[model samples]
Target: MNDTTTFKQSLTINLRVIGALLMREIITRYGRHNLGFLWLFLEPMMFTLGVTAIWSYTHANHLGSTLPIAAFTLTGYSTILLWRNMPTRCVSAVIPNLGLMYHRNVVLLDIFVSRIVLEVTAVTASFSTLGILFFSSGLMKAPEDIVPVLIGWMMLAWFGASMSLFVGALGARSEVIEKIWHPISYLTFPLSGAAFMLEWLPAPARAVLIWMPTVNCCEIIRQGFFGPMVHAHYDMSYVAIFNTCLMLLGLAQVRLVAERIAPQ
Candidate 1:
């Protein structure tokens, strides 16, 4: 076969492999239980809603005049659910599926990508449903600009997928990586722009925190959600450059891991 035809055939086979992996992952993770795959969306929604209720109740008097605590908490926590849970899901993905590698078309990259796709889809659906529910119930206003919100959501998903790939590969190579990532992921939660907004932070802190891609994404999302009512600070260029570099590094790591796992 010619080079172009070869490439196309390989691409088609890989796509089929990825699709099969996705279905297997969904069945493995969320089997035909109570809600089955529906739990994928409900799980995150429940977490966000629970937190929002507690925050709204306790801080009933303290929620700012500008943005309702429900709206703020929902936006921030939903984004957290999107980016935070991914690495956790992917950290041990390859080890359990190592036997599947015997199949010529099933590679390490396919395993990681399938898990990441599952996570991003779940969180996006959860976020969309919550936004609709909150707006219709009069708990929050509809977003002024959905385009930027979606762009920001995509950026966060990119960050999560890249981070998961990098960490998942490392975890497969070393038990130490798996141990360290658990604590590290917890520590990152507070600093991940989930609990507060960029405008609420002090000037010096804001300058430093904006360096986190998650923070920039949260700010961009809030800018769209709140519109003129609140000021949000973010740099899309920085997010783009950082996620791109991280994605490249992640792909390299996945390639290395794949080399180690290649059949003799």
Candidate 2:
């Protein structure tokens, strides 16, 4: 058979395996309820609203200073939530599914890619549907600049995929390392540049977080959604380089581990 035929057969086989796994994951999380998919949207919306309530209480004048409140908070919160979910989802990707490695056709990369697909499917739909509703209903306004928001989401997705794959490999190799990850994840938040706009950060602090790739992603997202008044002082070139390194390292580590962890 030609390479095309081989790839087609491979994809067809891979799709069956992946499809079954995806369905199991969805059912496991959402159950057989009518609102299964709806739950995904509700989950993020609820989290955003909870955070917004606190934000409004503490900083009553947040969006009043610039953009529309609902839109600003929804987009920002959803973007952060999307990036944050990836690592956690991936940590489970390689470990819990370790048994799948037994089959010659099933690879570790398959699991990682599957998790990424799941996150993307849920988040893209959730964000897009809610975003449109908010925009059309006059609950939120369009950004003065669209490019930044699109760039921001793409960057976040790439960074999330890269880091999660890397971190997932490390976590799979060592439980002790996984233990340490929780504290680090908690610490990353203050520096995450998630809840607040980058323009709000003071000079030196801004200098630091802006250089951090994920933070830069957040900055790009806010600039896209919020207009000229909103800004994130990130270095895009730095993030691109950082993600490249992480992707290579992650893929290498996975290859090394897959052989060792292959199920009987």
Which candidate has the top score in TM-score?
1
In angstroms, the error of model 1 at 64 is 4.1
Query: TM-scores of the models, in the given order?
Result: 0.95, 0.88
lDDT of 1 at 159: 94
Query: CA shift at 126, candidate 1, in angstroms?
Result: 0.4
C-alpha RMSD by candidate, in order: 1.7, 2.4
Clash pairs for candidate 2: none
The 0-to-1 C-alpha lDDT of every candidate, in the order given, reads 0.88, 0.76
**Candidate 1 worst ten-residue window by lDDT:** 57-66
Candidate 1 C-alpha lDDT tens digits along 1-264: 899999999999999999999889888888988888898889999999998899777875333555788788877998998888889888888778988999978888999998898899999998999888998999988888998899999999999998998999998888788888989988999889877787887899999999999999998898888889878899999999998999899899999999887543
Candidate 2 residues lying further than 4 Å off, grouped into runs, are 57-59, 62-64
